[model samples]
Target: MTKPTTTPAEPPYLRIVAAIRRRIADGELLAGDRVPSTRQIAREWGVALATATKALTTLRLEGLVETRPRTGTVVAGTAPPTASPALPSTPSASPVSSASSTGTAPEQELTLERIVRTGMDIADAEGLSALSMRGVAARLGVAAMSLYRYVPGKDDLVLLMADTAYGEESYPADVPEGWRPRVELGARTLWTLYRRHPWLAQLGPISRPLPLPNLMVHGEWVLSALEGHGLDPTRLFDVHVLIYSHSHGLAVHLEREAQAEAATGQSDDEWMDSRAPTLQWLAESGRFPAFTRIVGSLGDGYDLRLDALFEFGLAALLDGLTPIIEGREATSR
Candidate 1:
């Protein structure tokens, strides 16, 4: 006997939306709680960014969630109430609130600094993609065009935000004793800033760095460390750039990990466990003998510790630079 055929699955976005809706209805997600970010949704569901965005848009349309300026997208204070059967409804005698009638605030005490700070807060919480003039206006209870008067455009506003974020911390008044220690301090300082604002890592690529003044301030710290080491101008600048790249290279993953955790609603280890099937397949494949041996030896499991990795790589990199820094030729040694 032949079995009956089942219907094809719903589209991915619809599935995601339904899942989030169920979570809300089940009390797993309370009002005003942050929902999974778009990047998070994409990473968690193994769907395209657009699909995750569409799911979020659908939830917004349904009034299940809202975008708050400094807080990203969160569950709406109240779900859109269900519609009841229409009776002979009568109009209300009282008038609606004046603020509600106009759909805007009567007066806005707007400022450039306020706008930039709002943009930074949004970027810090939700990431760069969630930022826009319109969103800022919505948060400020003003028209979107009003922001244009204070800030030229999104690009200009982003530059200001970057500078402000980078300027949060300052280097020491007196530099460290040794060149190596000074460089280490500078690198760690930048890493700490990135830890505070992970979204900073998703900025421009290495070749196209931002011309923000505060960024140059951090550069000065690194440059001063390598200055009196007898290296040529090109070599000094190159070494500084390489050191900056090392911090940034590892830093980018901080934001990605945050997105993943939010989307999947799981810790790093839990997420790794979800992918155990693939790991098992790779181990059994035996094609990669080295990889198989490494996994085989791990009776418990290997923990991917980024902080430890960073320290390890930093030491290795500085060790390799020791020869050049000490003005010693490898052939002579």
Candidate 2:
């Protein structure tokens, strides 16, 4: 006697992909029309953001969707791929078994490096809040438990990811001349890393600094520049902290903005525009004349450009420190 075969249930992400695909095929979603964002999909389906992201990725792979700058994801201008009975799945063979059977290393063979890189990729795309061991496993096409073989847990994995991200940049062999230039280089380097990986700024508070080796590399650069400037050890370290905080304090908003967008599905401009009524009310209340006068002077409203602010702040900070650092040099002479 033979038993009947039962097909496996469709994955949540694929189901989302199919539903969106249907809308495109049925002409409900026209070409170049805005599609539901990942956050929207997550809310509508009660799925995790990772699942939502995967659904969109699947749609993109099928040519059903393409992302546009400032427009978010949209239906592709080109026709989507022809429909098939079902989406394809990975080979049934496990990574370990495949390696043994083929006498060659399988590409999917799990490793510490692969796990860390995948985690970093997830944190980079979505904010750190969306990152999870299960999401990393789903992205890698492996069982979640399998990750434990390489990493102890999410806490350790995040440290590894942070260290790897911090290591991406390095100082040149030919160092810049003068303490100010060196300090500036170090500060800008850290800022660049934070900009590249906004979630990095959210790692721990200033009181509990991350003890990552690559992070130490950055600290070493700044500390080396400040050394031998006739300042006491405490003062020199305080100066280093000040420089770090200047960059870090501003960079913290990068992650916050990303989180806000994900939660509200509104861009910075859109969010601010939505609050215009309140601003006008405050202006009319006349309780804050200085604020109203300054804001009303701007014809098109102010655009808060972080990059410009960073540069301006850096210049001002460096200018203020110049006298203090140089004064120490003169006193020592």
If scored against the real structure, what TM-score would every candidate get?
0.68, 0.71
lDDT tens digits, residue span 262-305, model 2: 56555565456556768899999999999999999998789999
| CA deviation > 4 Å runs, candidate 2 | 1-108, 328-333
What's the residue-level lDDT of 28 in candidate 2? 97
The TM-score measured for candidate 2 stands at 0.71
Could you report the Cα RMSD, in angstroms, for every candidate shown?
A: 11.6, 13.7
Which 10-residue span in candidate 2 carries the lowest summed lDDT?
83-92
The deviation in Å at residue 191 for candidate 2 is 0.8
Root mean square deviation (Cα) for candidate 2 = 13.7
Candidate 2, pairs of clashing residues:
none
- Model 2, residue 229: what's the lDDT? 72
- Candidate 1 regions exceeding 4 Å error are 1-108, 260-270, 330-333
